[model samples]
Target: MRSFVRVAERGSLSSVAREYGVGQSTITRHVAELEQALGVTLLNRTTRRITLTAEGARYLDDTRTILRLVDEAADGVRSATDRLTGTVRISCTAALGVRHVADILFAFQDRHPGVCVDFRLSDVQIDLVREGVDVAIRLGALSDSSMQRKQIGASRRILVASKEYLDRHGRPDEPGALARHAIIRMSNVSGSDRLVLHRANAEPSILPVGDRLLVDHGLAARRAIMMGRGIAPTHLWLVNDLLEAGIVEQVLPDYSPEPVPLSILFVPGRARVKRVRALIDALHGALRALPGMT
Candidate 1:
């Protein structure tokens, strides 16, 4: 059943065999035996690839549910007296993973030494189910409505630049003066041309920024700002350490871009697994402890 699930998801018998440290013939025999017992064609095999039959697709769902339930039942009983032991696969944005999330996972592992953490970092959002990720720490808005998620916190974003850059080019006291200075824009964010800033006891400011440098990654933009490239809006967690070290200063202390939400999204029934649940609980608190998160 485990082999079938891997074969269905990966669509390669040899790949599954390699992962399990077994021969291709062994994997083939396992699938053949399962097919013979079930009395159904589970997959269509060709030279190039294997595709699942309709029956196979339905069976895959049931298999996943059964596997999850079995793990939950076993782990639940063992966790009462024994140490929890399993792998918790997690996905997180690259910057946050480096700046904050990685430490959280490390601390979690310290507490549950028997548990293993599989951490993956990517700027691009990945399909949690296809990637076999138990949970994903997402920034900004979430698009998948079908997935179960918990709102962890929000990261405060602010306009910032290096002290040297501010000294070279005069600081903008008002939103209108920004047009005179170079703007470092994140190309990945939607509507990079316009910036909306909010302040207490004042109407929100909507300003159009002319980009002097464009970067997609948070660390890349941080590098640009530190080199005195230009002023850019960035998450406080991304540069909080630098800010404290006097490497960079907030461009406009009074105004800031809207705080981006931090969320933990998990695959259905994954939270029932003891290790995954433990990690999720640890993340909920640790993520909120980040400098800008609230």
Candidate 2:
């Protein structure tokens, strides 16, 4: 059942075999034997890829639930004689993971020595169930309504550039002046070509800005800003230390980008597991305490 669930999620028998440190033939036999017992085909196989059948798809959901319940039961039994033990898998946005979440995980592991962490970092939104991820630390507005989420904080974004760049290029006195200066943009986000700024008593200013360089990651954009490349609107958490050190200065200080919500999303079944619950509680508190997360 375990092997089948992994094979279903990963879509490859060989990959599951490698993960289990076994031969592909062994995994093939396991699936074949299971199918024989059930008298139903679970997958459609071809030379290049595998696809789950209609029945298989339904079975997959039930199988995952069964596996989760079994693990929960085992953990409940073990808690009587041992310290908390089990792996907690987490997925987080890349920049935040590198800057803060990794440190939080280290501290968590230090406190719960028997617990193991499987951490994954990516800027792209991934399907939690398909990837077998227990929880994801996400930024920006969430679109999925069905998933369980806990809003930890909000990420405030602001326009910023290094002093060296502004010294040579001059500062913009108004939002309209941004068109005359180079801007660094995040390529993956929609509307990277524009800046929307807000102030206390005035209407929001939407300005078109030309990109001098395009980067997909927050850290890359920060490096470009540090190298005096161009001005960028960035999450404060991504560059707070640099700002404090005076390595970068806020542009158009009175105006700011709309703050985006930061949340921890989890699979409903997985959140009930003890280790997963513990990690989520730790992260909710720690991430809320990060600089620029309000």
Say which candidate scores most in lDDT.
2
Candidate 1: misplaced stretches above 4 Å? Answer: 10-30, 47-49
lDDT (tens digit, per residue) of candidate 2 on 117-161: 989999999988767788999988898777899999888899999
- The positional error of residue 51 in candidate 2, measured at the CA in angstroms, is 3.2
Residue 84, model 1, lDDT: 82
lDDT of 1: 0.89
Tell me each candidate's TM-score.
0.92, 0.93
lDDT string, candidate 1, 1-294, tens digits = 878888888889998898678999998999899899999989889999998999999999899999999999989788777688988889998988988888888888888898988899998999887667899999989999878999988888999999999999998998888888889999998988998999899999998977668888988999999999989999999999999999999977889999999999999899988888888899998888889988
Query: What pairs collide in candidate 1?
Result: none
Evaluate model 1: give its TM-score. 0.92
Backbone clashes counted, model 2: 0
- CA RMSD (A), model 2: 1.9
